[model samples]
Target chain A: DAGITQSPRHKVTETGTPVTLRCHQTENHRYMYWYRQDPGHGLRLIHYSYGVKDTDKGEVSDGYSVSRSKTEDFLLTLESATSSQTSVYFCATSTGITLQETQYFGPGTRLLVL
Target chain B: ELKVEQNPLFLSMQEGKNYTIYCNYSTTSDRLYWYRQDPGKSLESLFVLLSNGAVKQEGRLMASLDTKARLSTLHITAAVHDLSATYFCAVDSWETSGSRLTFGEGTQLTVNP
Candidate 1:
């Protein structure tokens, strides 16, 4: 298993409040991804960083943002939490010359917006 | 747009039975991945198939990919209670070096005694 950890394992915040989740890795993987898992929706990509400061929006990037200033950390922030945004967030890391490599995941962060 | 779909969204099987889960993708891709997730837990990767007719097996589970049909299958042989979990399949294109994976809606499996 890759050494990936997500801080604030669980959180509950009111709607309209700003929230941030942190994903830290010790494997020094070049690729980091953030995804939100909802019931019946599977895992939707939020944002991903290919390298330090090189990131891109994913399928579900409308309400989220991410940053990767260092090789081992990627952060996902919600500007204003909404009830629909409540879901389990996961962080994954993969490293290889190609994207075909298998991705390793962190435990997960459960968030609830009331 | 890429879409990955899994069939039998929910399955309940008795222990020692056999079942197969199917995954289909909308577009062409270079690889497919199978992952298992326990309730409230993170995903654990099970297989990575890169080409058509590629097959891999671990324990009681076997996975095969048919790129021509854009389909993948995960077969459980003699299921056990401990095999209960949600399984997901993800596909990725071959265009970029760090392309993201588009995941399918997971298939939740429950193994009963």
Candidate 2:
């Protein structure tokens, strides 16, 4: 554990409602990422932040948006939740160093959108 | 697009048996990581292989990489019930340095008595 935590460990919400998941890290790492794990999909990247206030879209970023205003906090928001977005979300952190900056994962948040 | 594939999605072996899990990926990448996940938990890294022919061992588990063949293997010796979990192999993206990794399908191993 690299001092990472995700809020709403388990959540169930109805569709068409907005939702936000929070990832907080105490390691002061330079990079943060949001990923979703599904039964057949393994883990798919949704978004990542390289530094404070800097973020980039990943392979599966269509329905998700993210914000990083501070070094220790990253937020993933879904404007309107959908059934397809029901999955386990994980937050990960890295130091941004080449080769050695291996990504460490958080405990993960289990979200279900009906 | 880089593709990562792992064979034998499910394995059931008796304790004390030896088995290996194979990971194959497309494209060229310099690093690969092996991680283990128990049911209802996050992934925990087990090995980080940097180059072809790189081999690392811990306890009854060993991992090796073959960059030329775009393959990596995780060998388990004297399997134990404690080793029962889902193993995943991830290849780092070539587009960025330690930016992200493409994960394999994962192999679920069960060690039975």
The DockQ leader among the candidates is: 1
Chain A TM per prediction: 0.96, 0.97
lDDT values for all models:
0.92, 0.92
Model 2 ranges off by over 4 Å: B96-98
In the range B1-113, model 1's lDDT, one tens digit per residue, is 99999998999999999999999999988699999999888999999998889999999999999999999999999999999999999998543536678999999999999
Q: What is the interface RMSD of each candidate, in Å?
A: 1.8, 1.8
lDDT of 1 at B88: 98
If scored against the real structure, what TM-score would every candidate get?
0.97, 0.97
Assess the local accuracy of residue A72 in candidate 1 as a C-alpha lDDT between 0 and 100. Answer: 98
**Model 2 lDDT tens row, A1-114:** 889999989999999999999999999999899999998778888999989988888889998999999999999999999999999999999887667557899999999999
